[model samples]
Target: MPHAEVDGVRIAYLDEGEGDPILLIHGFASNKQVNWQYPGWVDLLVKDGRRVIALDNRGHGESEKFHDPEAYGAPLMAEDARNLLDYLEIPQADVMGYSMGARIAAFLTLNHPDRVRRAIFSGLGYGMVAGVGDPEPIAVALETDRIQDIRDRTGRAFRAFADQTGSDRQALAACMRSSRQKISEDDVGRIERPVLVAVGTEDEIAGSPHKLADLIPHAEVLEIPGRDHMVAVGDKVHKQGVLAFLNNIDA
Candidate 1:
């Protein structure tokens, strides 16, 4: 529940434990709890003696939710992470981002490579269409207010997360307008830190985010066999993949 004012926006983050610093960046429409805590990742990380800093980005969780597209720009988002690090007085640390978070992480690594000691990107995809996924089913879901429908279908647990960030039409529109960045394969290749790119095998975002890993010089790719983007974060297989990567860096 700690807040850090960075770049004129208030970011809510969990600053816990003591050891090598690791920043956890959640995805679009996801707060720290849903992405990390719900999946027991935050505990798993801190239990391993890592100093975990899990943040709620703008328009998500307890962070400021701005309607303006420009406020949520990718460059600005990356700067938010950098500013948080500055506020903590830490010069460098590991960064792990998922879904939309991964996109922002890529920019942070590209723009401020020196500040990142290592990086993790999951559910990565070059582009995203707000409602174009799954074709017919997605189209019907959109008609019935998919966000609410998802909550109703899945129960309050997941829907609450969607509502906490962007379960509404307006929020989704704002996310699509503001979240996309112009990172390319060339940009991916530029990160100097030890990198890990992972994606669920059945991810809805991109079929193969591991391709992104192949392009990055220091990246190791991980693909969880049967999980989708959403389930991947909670999957034991995904956890092991991340653990292995972090273990290598820790060594």
Candidate 2:
């Protein structure tokens, strides 16, 4: 339940274990617990002699809520992550983010490369290069009281997940209406840090992990076979790939 004051908002985060730090960012509508703790990511990283720091993004979990769409863009959200690192006085750490979190992490890596030692982008793919999906339908779904009223399949799924997570519907609506930023091929090519692009083989939302890996200069791809977006979060293949990646970094 610890919180950090960052950029005029209180961000809830978890700091556990001991060793090099790894900042974990959860996906849209998902809190740190559901996305990281429940999936055993905290434990896995901690057991590997690494410290894990995860935050509940703005408008989600116990963090401060903002009804303003201007406050929820990827750049602003990435600043929240950076501010958390600053608050903790962490000079640099490995940053790992999933889904929406991955987009935020990408912004962080692009804007403040010095603060990140390595980057892990999970549940993200060509969407990083191609651009984000439309947000209007999803925004409407968050505002709708009835989940069934959301006609778009993606909107319905996201709305249902938001309900399941007990998120602030209005705040999430604002978030959905905010900016959807995409990294350019030149920008991706400029990143020199070792990067890992992990995605589920069956994740339609992510497009293709290989496509994204091809954009980054020093990046590798890890495909979690037979897993979709939701299921891939806790997949053994993901855990192993991350551990192997970190181990190689230490070597």
The per-model lDDT (C-alpha) reads 0.74, 0.92
Clashes of each: 0, 0
Candidate 2 lDDT (Cα, 0 to 1): 0.92
**Consecutive 10-residue window with the lowest summed lDDT within model 2:** 176-185
How far is 168's C-alpha from truth in model 2 (Å)? 0.3
Tell me the tens digit of each residue's lDDT in model 2 across 1-251. Answer: 89999979999999999999999999988999999999899999999999999999999999999999987988899999999999999999999999889989999999999999999999999888886688899989889888767789988988988989999999998988874677888888888889999999999888789988998989999999999987899999999999999999899
TM-score of 1: 0.85
Question: What residue runs in model 2 are displaced by over 4 Å at the alpha carbon?
Answer: none
On residues 1-251, what C-alpha lDDT tens digit does candidate 1 reach at each position? 98988878899889888888999898866788889898898889889888999888887788877666667766788889999999999899889998778877878888999998899887774342122132223223323444555423323333444656454434434654667665666766777788887887777665456556667788787887888766788888778889899997678
Query: Which is the leading candidate under TM-score?
Result: 2
